[model samples]
Target: MDHEDSARFAFLHAAPVIGGAALLKLPPLLGALGDGLRGPLLAGSVAAFVAAYLAPRYLARHFEHRALIPFSIYCSVVGLGSLAYFAVT
Candidate 1:
């Protein structure tokens, strides 16, 4: 792909990660704002975002192949567990 296409592709991959990080932080962020803990919360949020962004890149170096298998397994386990829980209830 050309430069612009590559950039778009990168952004497309990144969008979900960025959105997830924001969503994960949103509830606590709003609570912190209401509680007047803006400064520390904002700092912590930035640190969390940076770590989240870098973690995959760091892990990719070690798990070059089969990087997604663990995630898939975890997801499958969670899905099955949720289904079992609801069925029991």
Candidate 2:
């Protein structure tokens, strides 16, 4: 049941995930546009979105269960850095 729930809920949750990602990324995108770097910034955003979407498929095929380790490390580093910064401030 848990596995079934996860399977069913995973894709269903992607909309909010993508929306939240876009929201979080929008400020830098807007700033880039203001700085007249619109074309490169937009291209980079598209490339990033494509890579994020496709990389999982490749990772699932090659790394299977360990596919998320790198991403987890990245998130952990960012999260800890944010926590430390806030604590120091």
Candidate 3:
């Protein structure tokens, strides 16, 4: 397929990985944390990935030449931010 299609495909693929990991071993996590927090925690983390992946795709759809640069920047910043946030707290 095309570049946009491929990007979207990859973006969709990331979702399951995010959610699955969230659910996996999450029973004990929620057990310790409580029911109220579990849904939001998994949801928020998955949402973060979706937002990070989408920002670049949106910019690239019309921007053409400048697309990849901003996309890369967005991904790096978002990915790194997620990493740091997850690592610290």
Q: Runs in model 2 with CA error above 4 Å?
A: 1-18, 24-28, 31-35, 64-89
Q: Clashes in candidate 2: how many?
A: 0
User: Cα RMSD for candidate 1?
Assistant: 6.5
Output the better candidate (2/3) by TM-score: 3
Q: What are the TM-scores, per candidate, against the unseen true structure? A: 0.49, 0.42, 0.45
Could you give candidate 1's per-residue lDDT for residues 23-74 as a string of tens digits?
Answer: 9877876784557767777898799778766765655454544355677799
User: Which pairs clash in the backbone of model 2?
Assistant: none
Model 2 RMSD to the real structure?
6.0
Could you tell me the lDDT of residue 30 within candidate 1?
76
Q: What is the per-residue lDDT of model 3 for residues 11-61, given as tens digits with 9 covering 90 to 100?
A: 778778867886886776779667678778788768987887676578457
lDDT of 2 by residue, 3-82 (tens): 33443456447758878988997787677455776777789879977876775555445543444568779999999999
lDDT of each: 0.71, 0.70, 0.75
- Model 3 lDDT, residue 19, Cα: 75
Leading candidate by lDDT? 3
TM-score of model number 1:
0.49
